[model samples]
Target: MPGKDSKEGKNKNQILADLAMADARRMIQAWTPPVWDEGRRPRISLLRAKKAVPSADGTDLVDWSREERNLGWDMYDKNFFADVVDIEGHHYEVFKFEFIEDISNKMKKALDDLEWVALDG
Candidate 1:
């Protein structure tokens, strides 16, 4: 059985995580692309929250590469490569591919500019 101190610490950690998630949600909601194409735009809500890890140097800085990898994993699990077809019965795999690539680049840019540490549910 854990001590009172341990339980309290866990509760405090949960509270902090909740707060961080809320902040990330707000940032994601506020983010917008320079050129908004509703058809090709990614569903921002699909993005998942990622846990922060310590820097490789054992400093307070975040491990950005790890964060990027986390984002990639989320993107992969979210089916970023899923196929799409137009209403006219035309299949444009290249179009969807380009759109996904563009969105990924934009998202990475946002992550850097916004200093976003995590996302929300």
Candidate 2:
């Protein structure tokens, strides 16, 4: 049988996973894609929070706003390509995707530690 510490660690990781999922759901709900057509109505703001990290320059810092903005753009592309977002009802289908790996082409195999990290609000 596994020890108490091992069980505790697993439980903690599970909690983190649950929290991350919730945050992701909220992000999806809050995002509004830019208007594409004259007849289509624009999306209104709901909620927005970004993910950030410390830059290689240390204190300089890599901001999450950029990444979040990029993610939004990528999402728009995906929607356009897939025709997933509804312009009439403002409803979007929730899809699962990896943050750094799936969205970033150049980032492939570049980010080791952050490969598994999910976007945070």
Candidate 3:
């Protein structure tokens, strides 16, 4: 059986994940593809990691070698392998696969719907 503290922790984690997803959605919606030739638009890449593990203290979130600047968003998923690219072709490894998996099914469906937006660019 799970304890009250454990349940609360899970809820907190879920809330954080939800917020992160919302932020990602907003960014994707607001992003404008760089101007291309008439009738052309740059392709944006949406990538995901194969797996991820939750970190309680974010110790695993730090990438020492990387320059470490905020992309104006947070992954909260802790994914470091796969990357989500912008219309300009910048790569971002923001969300972890496992963290995404833990989110509610409705959120997952919403994310799936966003896939078309990535390709539409």
Candidate 4:
């Protein structure tokens, strides 16, 4: 019972979400995770919201919606809160950027797989 415009909007939203998710993965993978010795700790705060700038041609670019940003932020915050990784004798607070990056990758993968399945079906 959906109207044509409503259906089109839904499709557009889906595409936008997929693109934003992909951008998130790229942002996350661009930086290497910090590896510090037990005596040293990172000084970066991981709780801050970061702006993800996805580079793509105008036709390919999906301007990230507020919902997409919030979704990415939620993933980033979850990783930031669950960060007490121990390496050897060194206890390192996982780099927030790295954590968020990994999360973005995971999200993009999931969304990509879903999009593929939808296309196939």
- In Å, residue 39's CA in model 1 sits off its true spot by 16
Query: Least accurate stretch of 10 residues (summed lDDT) in model 3?
Result: 85-94
TM per candidate: 0.24, 0.26, 0.26, 0.25
Question: Each candidate: what lDDT?
Answer: 0.40, 0.36, 0.41, 0.42
Name the lDDT value of residue 116 in candidate 4. 70
lDDT of 3 by residue, 1-121 (tens): 4532354365555556657867877897887644456534423223323233344655233222123332323342223213352221112223345344433443455455557556764
* Model 1, backbone clash pairs (residues 3+ apart or across chains), number: 0
Write down the TM-score for model 4: 0.25
In model 2, pairs of residues that clash are: 51-64
Instruction: Please report, as a residue range, the 10-residue window in candidate 4 with the lowest summed lDDT.
Output: 84-93
* Best lDDT among the predictions, by candidate number: 4
lDDT of 2 at 29: 86
Candidate 4 lDDT, tens digit per residue, 23-71?
8779977956555675343222222223333333332232243235233
Clashing pairs in 4: 28-101
Candidates 1 and 4 compared by TM-score, better number: 4
What tens-digit string does per-residue lDDT give for candidate 2 at 1-121?
4532343344454456547767877897897856667534432222222323223333211232343433344655533321121111111111124333333432332343233332321
TM-score of 3: 0.26
Compared with the true structure, the alpha-carbon lDDT of candidate 2 equals 0.36
